[model samples]
Target chain A: MIRLHLPQPLSAGAALVPSLDQSRYLTQVMRLKLGDAVLVFNGQDGEWRCVLSDILKKGVVLKAEAQVRPQTIGPDVHLLMAVVKKSAMEFAVEKATELGVRHIRPMLTARTQGHHLRLDRLDAIAIESAEQTGRMDLPVIDDPAKLADVLEGWDPGRRLMFCDETGGAPVVKALSALEDSGRPWAILIGPEGGFSPQERERLRALPFTTAVSLGPRVLRADTAAVAALTLWQAAVGDWER
Target chain B: MIRLHLPQPLSAGAALVPSLDQSRYLTQVMRLKLGDAVLVFNGQDGEWRCVLSDILKKGVVLKAEAQVRPQTIGPDVHLLMAVVKKSAMEFAVEKATELGVRHIRPMLTARTQGHHLRLDRLDAIAIESAEQTGRMDLPVIDDPAKLADVLEGWDPGRRLMFCDETGGAPVVKALSALEDSGRPWAILIGPEGGFSPQERERLRALPFTTAVSLGPRVLRADTAAVAALTLWQAAVGDWER
Candidate 1:
């Protein structure tokens, strides 16, 4: 069951109060009434089983029964993709979150040819994805920034696995070199038009960047982002651990 | 540049003869005349560079210059996803093809809901994806079959890494264990409603089945299919090799 957003803190030993917005969804949308059960989870606390107590004009009330599972951190893997079309970008973010990305950085590259991103709409999609996927914590969605700036300010500690559209070293070579090293890493993917010659050169020259190929095929930006992340996680992230 | 379908083989010193359809695309749509360069590739032969010779109503002619890279097979991986909605299913297939899946098997489960499938359209998507990705071979698309039939006639040599929605062992565990043998493998992912209890039980009983979890999240059927395939390829296929 999906968790509803409640206004106030869920008291451990007190009555459970679902927000008015959620109350309407529960009563009107879901047709769930008093005495009906629902799963509740605050991003702060563990998931809970709540029973409806009173359906008030303002909202509805419930009493917490027990905790299902506590909120835990997912992988340290982050995905940084050059902003593509709105639909593809949204799909990439949702899939990245589901694949256990802790941070999503939508970078703007020289070749990026997309419109303004609706941050609120993107956030809602992420939230709904998290709720549906049973993810306790939603990924941190960072503001979009220029690729050059993001690279210039990059820390040396985090390994940057750049998904080279030109098809460089086999992904296995890059991934195997990082195995057994407990290091935080991120995957970089290009937009639809792909990286310009200068941008590609700059990325390839970065000391922290490790260029990798996603096989022989040219994947769309969204697909590349997800595939690169999946490869990273399986090769070196918590999947191997 | 996306590879264009040209007549004749793509071998060195071979004369190209574009059919009427390709001639129209080159003359009318692309507005390319004589002496314009284009990239062409045959599934068996490597990609090639050719210069347009003549633009005739009957056909277009071109002469091959030099051979590109030799044809190389993609990652030795296959995907089996329960049939989903039309768009979602198409998205999954396109992404899978871009991610270098060698084969795609669509299945129908007991709890499967959606039914509309446009096989021809999906095939076109795969062809376009391959042409865009510079793939020398197209991934085989299989017709939808009953889940029980797929399992009962399972090959003993091939391992089936089933994505269990109920949360079994993390994907990494099963992948690591399988990596040692380096055997051929396929990933089985269920639909939105997931497998029925009996379906799950029968799957668990299969000697070739290894249930793996796609983390703690409940990803959609399409996302789960891609994630499972990526993880499998990384753990035991070309990524590790």
Candidate 2:
């Protein structure tokens, strides 16, 4: 059965009540009919087994049969990347969601470009990726914020593993030093031009930031995002278990 | 200074010889005249500091002044990914080179599309990546070969870690159990549709292979390639040192 993220609260024996948009998708795209089984999950309520109860001209309705799995949170990992070009940024966002990132913060740096992000399209990408990857939750995508503003209000307990383009400590060393603390963490990757001198200085001065090297080579922003996340996942995330 | 690969052996006080293509690049594209300093490196010889000695219509010559760094190989990690679509495959090859992968083997699987890959273009990408990333060594891109053939004639000393999409043993567990005896290793990533059932069974029967899961999500082949390599580097490569 195809999985769909329904907006309404889902409980045992409750009607599915898909929105008009979702109903079109179920009827037209998936060609689902009455009595067809579909897995439905609301971010707040747990996942539920649902059956199409009625198909009307305006919309389709589903009846929740039973609760399949309880709502659960993903690992406390966030992917923070400077807004890259349109195609690359979308690719990074899709991969980050698949890799279990719970939040994606698009950073606006001195050299960052802003007019490319389509918030609605990106949100759809996240939902589709989560559904395909068997993720029960979707990553929250925040509006792009200036780099200085992001660091100014940084959480002290959360460590930001900055992928320093100039190269610094190796990722393994940085991860080992921070893994025991259990701090909610974020990985920051710069844009194509990289951080300006002032931005670099401010980030370096922040107490919660640690500069780390992915390798000797200079990876593209998108590649850096995935590589940094992979390193973090291997070193400190649930992969260890 | 822009670094370019001149795979010929460099000797102390030897005259820098630019090829016909390189001569055009220096004189036309870069607009460099006599006495301009450019960096050059060969895979076998170390990086060299060269000053343009003469500029002619047909050719250009430079004096190799000094050695910047000795030739050294990166971590002996190879990336073997099943060939994907043209653009995605090229992107993987470029990123793999940038991330310090020493060898790239494009595996031809049963379900692989027989799209002709341009070897010359991939080689150029590797060279350009090495030049931009400050890596003295360029990764070697091998001709595409069958996965079963590559695994059948594999070296016994080198370990092969396959990214099993079915999520079996956690990757960290498989990586930790790998004995880092300083032997060359490779990471194998499957195609988008994943390996066929028979192919998976055959892979599992291999004694030198390790099946690892990249968390719960179904990652694209490109993302899985980077994730698997990062895990390997952290667990057993120079990062551990």
How many backbone clashes does every candidate have? 2, 1
Candidate 2, position B134, lDDT: 72
| lDDT tens readout by residue for model 1, A1-241 | 5475443455455487666777788889888867777777666776777788888999888877777787677767788878888998899988888778889998999988866888888877887777777777777888899988988888888989998867777675577665635788888898887899999899888887888876545678888888887767666776545
Output per-candidate TM-scores for chain A, rounded to 2 decimals.
Answer: 0.90, 0.94
Worst 10 residues of 2 chain A by lDDT: A174-183
Q: Using DockQ as the measure, which candidate wins? A: 2
User: Candidate 1 at residue B63, lDDT?
Assistant: 82
Q: Estimate, for each residue in B1-241, the C-alpha lDDT of model 2 and write its tens digit.
A: 8687886778878886778988898879999878888889988788899888998777998788899988877789899989888777887877777778899999999778777888898898888778877778888889999998998899978888888887657776567676664778898898888988898888888887888888756687877887887777767776555
Kindly report which residue stretches of model 1 are placed more than 4 angstroms away from their true locations once superposed: A5-8, A12-29, A50-67, A166-183, A193-210, B5-42, B45-70, B167-173, B176-183
Name model 2 segments beyond 4 Å from true.
A1-72, A85-88, A109-128, A165-169, A177-182, A192-206, B12-35, B51-64, B110-116, B177-181
lDDT for model 1 comes to 0.78
